[model samples]
Target: METTYFTKKDSIVRQIWGKADTILFIFAGAAAEFALNKAVDWLYYTGRLPKDPLGRLFSTVNYAKVIVFAEEKTAFQAIDQMNKIHAKIEENRGFKIPDWAYRDVLFMLIDYSIRAFEALERKLTLHEKEEVFQVFLKVGKGMKIADLPTNFKDWEIQRRSQLQDNFEYSDFTKDLFLQYKKHLGIIRYRLLLEAQILMAPKRIKELLNFRNQSILIAIIPFYRLSRIFKIDYILKELILPKDYKSDIKALDHSAAH
Candidate 1:
């Protein structure tokens, strides 16, 4: 019997999430925006995010990979599990996580998937962008998030509005950045900031006080050449924590399965 996947095999969503570098860039963008999000205190409630940011990143990546690469039944199980986890968090916190906050995260996944892929690879056609949006839209629906925009154009408008409305620099933002710096060390932390500059939206850049330019923009051509020569892993090794080296390598192979 043929197996059915949650994300179709030939889908652009698969292509976007299939590579380690793109996934890294996606989360790098997320890290910056997540810091500034008004809902970031929700993340702090568990104390896990601040204590083990990279571990949390890998856990998130694993879930995303399962949703992107696993069979339909398994993928839904992962989604349902995520919902249950959040429901429990809400139960403990004595209030629901805002519907808009749920939408904000779904939007982040959609937006960063495109941004990271384009920054690392090539530009996506408008249709491919729409494909990216649709895939995450399904995920949002599965999670029972309300008020999601129905199509790509609507999403663009909502996305812009959310970027404007949902973010503010707060004490959480300051402490999250400090945690990032602590876990990543000084040089790697700087590199994460540079990667964020490449993929973060204009508003995020301003909120983070990041300059408009990133050195990675100039270095990307060389990086692509390094990929061709199969030496990019060396640079990745230098940039990421040693504890996550195997997890990072596994990300490249996971999508192929």
Candidate 2:
């Protein structure tokens, strides 16, 4: 089947998201939010994240992948389904999820989309960055999030404020890191933390007590060098989790429509 413009087989978003390393890096940033954002943490009261943080994150990534790469009708359905799920969570919680918190998640997607791609590949053009912003802007519109900025520049300003207002170092943050350590092992968890520190907003790094550093920045040169040598797959295998190795391997640069 032919792809639509949104998920066109060669679309920039598809190619960015199709790489497993990019998805993982995106979640590394998102992981900081999940750990520190109190309002956002309320959405996970089911204890799923506490038990299996990586699994919960991958579930979110899978939902987004379906929405991004599926055909228009199917993509809309996936999005509608996601909205309904959030609505149900709010109903059960007996209070509305705050709009700022909703926007925070949207911003993370936008920020991490850029961070992940730049880490793995070359820097995107300004136009391409706007495209990343637009894709998630559309997703947020589908979920009916209120007061989103009209464009990427405005959104970048608002995103910084949201990060400042929404996140902190709480007991939830402490426990979530412990869970990440349990799941990823000590070495991988340290790597994950460093990745998060590198990609997170400056305030978030302060809240997490992580120094500003990019282990990935130093390593990205090697990643790019490997790509030039066509041995990138070897490095990817070494970095990703053994349990999800097969699943990550299946991600393709040009997924079928």
Candidate 3:
């Protein structure tokens, strides 16, 4: 029998995610929003996210790639494992993670995938954006997350509402930014801020007090040129810490394949 992947072989979702730079931008946006999320305390609950924010970022990337690249059965198993892990967390916490919190995460994946791709590449067609939404919607369904918006247009509305309703700069947000600065050090932390400015939504930027423009906006054209000469990995290396060089390199599925 032929292998069936969770994402189809020619999928635009794969094209967006298969590149290291795009994936980095996705997480840059996510990292900012995650810190501001009302439910960020659940991430802090285990002390893992606070201890090593960059490591946690890479770990989440690995899980996402497994779902995006693996065969269908393997992808379902990965999703099941994620559900069990969350169930255990809920068990320990003596309450369920809010369904809206779950939906917020799913929305992040969908939103950032589009934002990152557009920032680094080009705008996706309406159909391509829908493709991205549907893929993550399936993952949400797999996790048994309820009341997800059924289609892309509806998702856009819900996404905006969630951004307005769910984010605030609490103490958790402050401490998490401190953790990010600590792990990433001063220079890279600043770069992260710039990337977030480029990738995050207006509400996220407003809440975080990020400036309206990022220096990365000017640099992106040069960076895209470097990709043509096949030297962009050098810049990616400099953007992240030395310890995660391998992880950063592994993110380029083109290199692995």
Q: Estimate the TM-score of every prediction.
A: 0.98, 0.92, 0.97
Give the C-alpha miss distance for residue 217 in model 2, angstroms. Answer: 2.2
Q: How far in Å is the alpha carbon of 228 misplaced in model 3?
A: 0.8
- Candidate 2 lDDT, tens digit per residue, 1-257? 75564455666788778877788888898888778886746746776778878888878877777777877787778889988987888898888888888887788888988988887777898888888888888888888999999788998899888877778788888888888888988878888988897788788888888787777678778877887899988876767789987767665543644
Model 1 per-residue lDDT at 87: 98
lDDT of 3 by residue, 1-257 (tens): 89998998889989988988888899898899899999999998989998888888778766887799888999999999999999999999999999999999889989999999999999999999999999999899999999999999999999999999999999999998999899889999999999999998999999999889999999999999999999987887777789887887787854234
List clash counts for every candidate, in order.
Answer: 0, 0, 0
Where is the poorest 10-residue window by lDDT in model 2? 248-257
lDDT of 1 by residue, 57-92 (tens): 678767887798888899889999999999999999
lDDT of each: 0.91, 0.80, 0.90
- Model 2: residue 139 alpha-carbon error in angstroms: 0.7
**Deviation in angstroms for 64 in model 3?**
1.2
**Superposition error at 156 for model 3 (Å):** 0.3
Q: What are the C-alpha RMSDs, in order, of all predicted structures?
A: 0.9, 2.0, 1.1
lDDT of 2 at 32: 84
Pairs of residues at least 3 apart in sequence or in different chains that clash in candidate 2:
none
